[model samples]
Target: MLLAIILVTLIVLIMLRVPVAFSILGTGFLGLVLLGGLGHALPILETAPATAVRNSSLSAISLFMLMAQFMLMSGLLDSLFDAARSLVGRIPGGTGVASVGAGTAFAAVSGSSTAAAATLAQTSTKRMLSEGYQQTVASGLVASVGTLAAMIPPSIILVFYAITAEASVGDVLVAGFFPGLLIAIAMVATMYVGMAFQKGAVPAGQRSTWAEKWKSLWHASPLLFIFVAVVGSIFLGIATPTEAAALGALVALILVVARGRFTTQKFLVAVAETVKSTAMILAIVMAAHVLGHFLTETRTAPKLVQAIEDSAMPALLVMVLIAAFYVLLGFFMDQVAIIALTVPIVLPVVEELGYDAVWFGIFMILLAEVGMITPPMGLNVFVVSKSSGIPAVVVFRGAFPYVVVMLLMAMVFLLWPGLVMWVPNLMG
Candidate 1:
């Protein structure tokens, strides 16, 4: 009854358009009161919020967000995209593929999918649309491909998952490297195939000159160095994950200022945006803590775990079901909120099934990436549409093929866990 009430109340509040954080916290608090009375619930309410704020792992969130914000405002994002375009612009549907490539590169720096989608949408979508690309193709590619940002290394999602699941943040981040690259490769291949069949869909354009390409490459070198420095130091044991983030942010800021792209106005704006995004993420996380606490106190997670164990479902099938649930929920909820609310319930089952926590973390991120492009509530779709002034349907249609690619990538990871485990194993 308590679990059902919490679930129902959360759903109702979400349907009523309550902010996700509030809905989670309110339902959890209400459920706690019902289960243990005001005496117990009040203390939980007071204590959980403080505990949530004091969490050290959460410091990574602000640092990473600040890094992304500074980079975006610094104009480095555009330089990276231009370099990607120069490299891939000659192939069929190359612009779209370039967007995915650029997005993946940006993901290394930004760490958030929404920021990637928003930044790329602002940079690439307009150009693609104005160049006469089909609205569906342009919008969909951006929306779906932007998800690569979250799968790539330096992902905020991976960091959060690592912290919450008590896994190594560096290991989880390293584990994502290959799978994220695979997704990008698959998405690019899908674009090539789609363009092959529908030749007129993506017109071939003039290939960039060697000189021009080299110029763009030179301009993007700083971003590459930042990536190598941060991810490399962690992999080499020279710096911890938190230290890498701090170093990355500092390097990014230096690059921005050296390029003369960091104005006082832009700096302030980046700070403001970082604060807003970070606060929103933290709020949902705190609420999730409350929900997770309630679920644990009520033994709801244990009951579910026992039921799953009793069922004769194969471990692989269980993973598929969980992935499907994420896809469905992704349509309605933000990825961070979903992770926070479900990780406590799901991670224990994953452990019992004998999967590596770091590997499972990558799997979860891949699934969430798919969710970002999947439906009526796909945030990236809305972002792409808004940026391109294209209809959401067009974007959804364009993203369909990429979604298949993501699903296929998920299946590959499921079948050959080595794709995710290899890097981390090497590091260990």
Candidate 2:
């Protein structure tokens, strides 16, 4: 009953606009006090933040964030869009196709959905809009593709999930690659189909000559190399995610300097942004650790698992239920907050069902990402709308089809878990 009350309080706090970290911390500490008295709760409240930050793997968040920030300041994201456009902009729905292509590439370096969407929206949305593409279609396609960042390697969310679930981070990162590609291809195909049926949905581009395409590829090569080094070295076991992130950051700094755009101010700006993002992420981790402690003390995970098992439902059915829970919560809550709050509860249940942790990590991220493009609170939709100067409803309308594409991809991953596990298995 105490657990039920505390859970209700947590939900109310979140609904009342309290920050997730504080919501978790307050509810958890209160629960701990109620269950164990003040003496037990006091030490935890005192030590939780330090213990959480002491996690070595957590350092990867900062390093990767630095790598992404430096890469962004270097102006490589624009080059990525241009390169993809040069290669594919002549096809029907070429601009939309190029958005997916560039989003995938930029996701490799930026490791952020918001950054990828903002960059493309700022640089490509206006041009695509000018090219006779429907505003909703163009905005939706760009917003949807930005979600690739969540599942692609170097993903911040995957890193946090692996840590929370006690899974191998490297394997989790590797597991996302194929599923990410599959979704990317699906988005591109959906774009093609949409363009096919609608007249003047997308205006054709002047096809670039082979020579021009080659030049564009050459311009994008440096960032591509950094991406490969960061992700490749991790897959090959040459470096930890943190070490590879440092290496990537260093290479990005060098490239920025080489491109004659590096400045002390720009470097400082990157560092500042990295610090801000890292701090926010770590705060949430600390709060989650506290809540996890409360959950452990109450045997909440075991009970939940037992309750589900007692129902005698199929494992796949249980998974679908969990996915539905995530999607429903995602409509109203931030994805990161949803992951932080629920992973502690759901992960043990997932493991109890004989699912691979890495596969579930990828699956969970895809589900969370679907919420990112869906209505009422879609962050990507708002970001694209603001960046593209389109109405949010227009962007939301555009994003609706892609949301279906994501849901379909989620089903595919569930049906064939090996598609997510294959690359990670190969790494072993």
The TM-score leader among the candidates is 2
In model 1, where do residues sit more than 4 Å from their true spots?
Answer: none
Provide the clashing-pair count of each candidate structure. Answer: 1, 0
Clashes of 2: 0
lDDT of 2 by residue, 1-428 (tens): 99999999999998898988899899989999999999999899899878988979988778878888888878877888778889888877777778888999888887788888888899778878888889978899999988999899888888888888889988988788889999999998888788778877878775889998999888888987787888999999999988887888889888888888888998899899999888888888888888888999999999999999899999989999998888888887876788888988898899999998889999988998888888777999999999989999999988888888898899888889989999998987
**Native-referenced Cα lDDT, model 1:** 0.84
Query: Candidate 1 on 1-428: residue-level lDDT in tens?
Result: 76887798899998889999999999998888888899988888888977887877777778888888878767888887789889988876678877888888988788878778888888878778777787777778788778877777788888888877879889998888888888888887887788778868887764899999999999888898679767888889998888888888899899888988878898888889889988998898788888877898988778888999999789999989988987777777777888888888888888887788999898887887776887767888888888777888778888999888888888899889998999999997
Please give the distance, in angstroms, between residue 346's alpha carbon in candidate 2 and its true position after superposition. 0.8
Q: By how many angstroms RMSD does model 2 differ from the true structure? A: 1.2
Off by over 4 Å in 2: none
